[model samples]
Target: MTKPGRTLLKVQGLTKRFGGLVAVNNMTFDVHEHEVLGLIGPNGSGKTTTMNLISGAFPPSDGSITMNGQRLSGLAAHQIARRGVSRTFQLVRVLPGLSLVDNVVAGAAFGYRKRWGAEAEQFARGLLERIGLGDHMHLPVGSLTYIDQKRLELARALAGEPEVLLLDEWLAGLNPTELQEGIDLIAELRREGRTIILVEHVMDAIRSLCDRCVVMNSGAKIAEGTPRDVLSDPEVIRAYLGDE
Candidate 1:
């Protein structure tokens, strides 16, 4: 088990409003270095919205976000990526026309440290190989299966060598065996001390990966603690299973 270190990301009183609806309300949390923090909730609970705010895909309507004490709330998505934050989308996104290696190379060239030319291509290739896409490096992304595309997206995110990796349901569409493979891959990442914020509906993955969990319902946090504790919390149970 990796012991969590200093606070790496801080989200304080974050809120977002879309017209009359509040997507996230006054949420606050701290993600420690080397920790896998699970953001778990039922559908429509603002989990992805919160992730969007953190990744700069959507700016918060209120409150602040900081990484290692540097303000991140106002930065653009690309700027945030350059500052060591990388993410895979809830829906798989890959460059359909580009070869797998080119897709990852894009990430390496534009990511945090900005590798270029041979260095960038080499780094991208290694990441693809690590993520099990080496044999298909030159193939167009459109030719890959859904799970393989997911793998490519993750590799692209990792190509940046990000300080914090946000995985939004990277395990969503896997079959039983593929799910286990996905889980094991993530476990390896955890062992490598990657700091991650995972927004997922798979309880098994949550239990196996998360050091702690924060549960939300209707865009507001309802519970937080270890997976064992939070999963058993009455309110969290109610949020998922409904009141009886």
Candidate 2:
């Protein structure tokens, strides 16, 4: 676990382009060790593109990504994973045909951080238990509820034991009680001291979990600060919240 205030990940002049469209535009920021940094923006503001760049899903069109003094821009996703960066997709990516435990175990076996063996299986089982899916370990993921699929995604990400975890709208669909449960799970992840970059629309989760926030619009960052401050900013209100 990294201490607060030490820059663990550095993104400088990050930009991404798809043909004529600029998906992300010259955004720069530092994610401190163990900071729950919220990345919020209106739709098409480049939030997901930013996540992809940080996690090496795609190379940047311009600028750099560095984690603890190492350049990460040119690396492949698996290479980046070995470097201790991990993430969950906004659309859950679980293997529907596999048993739940096997789904996590497959990821665990391939991660750059750990060896695949009995020990790894045991670790995967432990993660399922912690994510509240141990009883369903033998069940095919196709039969699981959406919420449980989300939980399985999280557990797969955790199985890699990453230093930085990027969550893309992990709380998009849930009731009030379910939302709080999601919030509590995030709080617990924070307690474990993982550096988190949360790309989410849920304000209550933002206020509850984020130590700081970065807001974007038109593929470029427009405002950044604490949740209370950013949410109240006139520009943010106009760009995202609308006059109310």
Candidate 3:
């Protein structure tokens, strides 16, 4: 089976600015198919802004983004998602009134609108089981623990069948065991041939999961290399320390 990470998503000259403040500065990178690329930075480093641009939350100030040779510039978020891209937010977006199955079904519906009828619900049920939420299929999303909610978000994104999945701080609030589970889940996704681009503050996850990493400081790409190389660079170290 062909892996999603084997394909390449090219982001070139991607820049975004709010007035005189540049949130992302001419950043360029490639997310390889079937690989995990970790994106790390301190507060206000434009990590979220970069994710927003690539996911089509807004148009880039100046740049071109392409996936599988398709131009992604000027597309809306949903449109981009339909084009084989999906993202999980830092805040965990799920419907409180919906059941676990329903939340994932909603995601399936987004990509399978034309295939409605019994098929949609059937597909959602299968996906929920695959995501390890079979037992909670009928439980209200609001009643699940925080960890379960995070899993729901993952299942929703997975429902899109995206070639590229962007995870924004997915492990932020988890305890040690939960964090490990999340890490293993992501790693398993990679093994299942999914490509992932993760923005995280957790160094341990980045170190264990990413094949390569990109470091940003103040909205600019300061370094891109192996985790050890970038993490140990004097410049990168100082940047983390708030020095120029």
Top TM-score: which candidate number?
1
Clashes of each: 0, 0, 5
lDDT by residue for model 2 over 1-244, one digit each (tens)?
2257699999999999999999999999999998999999899899999999999899999999999999999899999998888889989999887777777887687665775888888889999999899898878888888788999999989888888999999998877887888899998998888899999999989988998899999999999998999999999989886767
Model 2 scores a C-alpha lDDT of 0.89
What's the TM for model 2?
A: 0.96
| lDDT by residue (tens digit), candidate 1, 9-106 | 99999999999999999999999999999999999999999999999999899999999999999899999999999999999989887888888988
Where in model 1 is the C-alpha error above 4 Å? none
RMSD of 2: 1.7
User: Candidate 3 residues 4-117, lDDT tens each?
Assistant: 344479989999989999999999998888888889888889998999998898799999999999998789988888788888998999988777777777777675242355
Clash count in backbone of candidate 1: 0
Distance (Å) between predicted and true CA of 49, model 1?
0.5
The better-scoring model by TM-score among 2 and 3 is 2
Ordering by TM-score: 1, 2, 3
Worst 10-residue lDDT window for candidate 1 reads 137-146
State residue 145's C-alpha deviation in candidate 1, in Å: 1.0
